[model samples]
Target: MTRRTSTSIGFVAVLLWALLALFTVGTAPVPPFLLNALTFALGGALGVSWVTATGGWHKLHAVPLRVYLFGTIGLFGYHALYFSALRLAPPAEASLIAYLWPLLIVLFSGLLPGERLGPLHILGACIAFSGAALIVAPGPDGFTGGIGLILAGLCALTWSGYSVLSRRLGAIPTESVAVFCLATAVLSLPAHLIFETTYWPAAPAGWLAIVGLGLGPVGLAFYVWDIGMKNGDIQLLGASSYAAPLFSTLILIVAGLADPRPSLLLAAALIAGGAGLAALGSARAQRRLIK
Candidate 1:
């Protein structure tokens, strides 16, 4: 594929990632551990089944055990820290802080062999983060300082670290994501059994939420993101990623899951502008490199 086409596809795929917020709907009715476990379990099963039926199941065995180990630790750690923080802090606050991974990814990309750390990337990250902060800024009773904040920071770290490593390991079969998800399910099952009550989604809405989470955000998004980050323009993807939270908030408001807040408009401007600036800067740099 042409570089331009690939970049456009990656950009669109990452934007669609905003659908990930659908995972939030499931969280209201399901315990975090159970929600995570079930989502991964069901989704992973489908992935495995598809690969097997298509004669690609050997691809799973071909993946290095180390990737499985790292994927488990990284993804599970992200889930544990991020969800636990939600219980301790306001969900908005926790989410805002945790979503810092995009900026972190931009910064971390510099460490990868071919990725360059440009000033525009840094500036755009700051602007995007400012917007994120504005949107999740606390109401009168929302901000409680403690472990939640620390956990949120760690969540960002683990994810940023994971993304970089995933890119470096991009040679691994994409089917490895199924194994990664299954590992998460197996690891999370004990926590679900011990600390949480296991109950399936009962109402139609609840069931819908769970199934949606399993199929979309928690499942397929991972596959798309893996390839996008590995081959697409990393800085552009990082800058554009700010849109995920924005998209989530807008969708929530539209769905009546969240009340509308005035800050969203300003947040939209800052994030969109930052993403645009970063993307433009990257394009100019590529043109210069070609020249």
Candidate 2:
């Protein structure tokens, strides 16, 4: 696919992720690891079905074992750190810290071979981060330093690293994400058994939310993201990722789960402006390549 097409596909992941908080809230009382196992199992099943229908089973065999390990670690490690961070630290602060992956993705992409990081990309990422901060930053309960904060930072690093490194593995088929999801599910089941109390979703809405998470955010999102990171405009994707938190908050407000705030308007403007700048930078780079 063309770079533009792949980037658009990648942005779909960002849009899907916006619903993460909403769906997660619906899966209430189901502890994190248990939720992870359930959702990932569904996600893996979704991928397996797609692979079977497409007759792409041969591609899966070609992927190296190390790649599977890498993918599994990326998916499992990120959630493990993120869940632990939230449990130990205040949710707001931990979320803000963990959300640094987008900014880090932009920064880390600069080091990748054949990728150019223009000033606009850096500026846009920073501005977008500020917008995300407005949404996820601490409330009346201010920052308190702890190991959770440290884990949150690592959470950001782990995800950003996973995303950027995926670009180097462009030869790997997107279908390989199926294995990643399944392995994550397997790993999470044991973790849940060890550390979390087993609780099923009490209501149909909760079960629906888990299914939604598996099919959209955790399933198709990862597949498209792999294609995008491998072939699309990484810088633009990185900058645009800030919209996840912005759109997520809007979803909560629309669902009557959160009170509408004036800050959201300003945050929206900043994120839009930043994404615009990043797009302009990508356009410039493309034009340069054409010349």
Residue runs of model 1 more than 4 Å from their true location after superposition: 1-16, 85-93, 135-139, 142-150, 199-202
Question: Candidate 2 has which clashing residue pairs, if any?
Answer: none
What lDDT does the true structure give each of the candidates? 0.71, 0.81
The CA lDDT at 101 in model 1 is 79
TM-score of each: 0.86, 0.87
What's the residue-level lDDT of 114 in candidate 2?
80
RMSD of each: 2.7, 2.8
Where's the lowest-lDDT run of ten residues in candidate 2? 88-97
Q: Look at candidate 2 and tell me the lDDT of residue 61.
A: 86
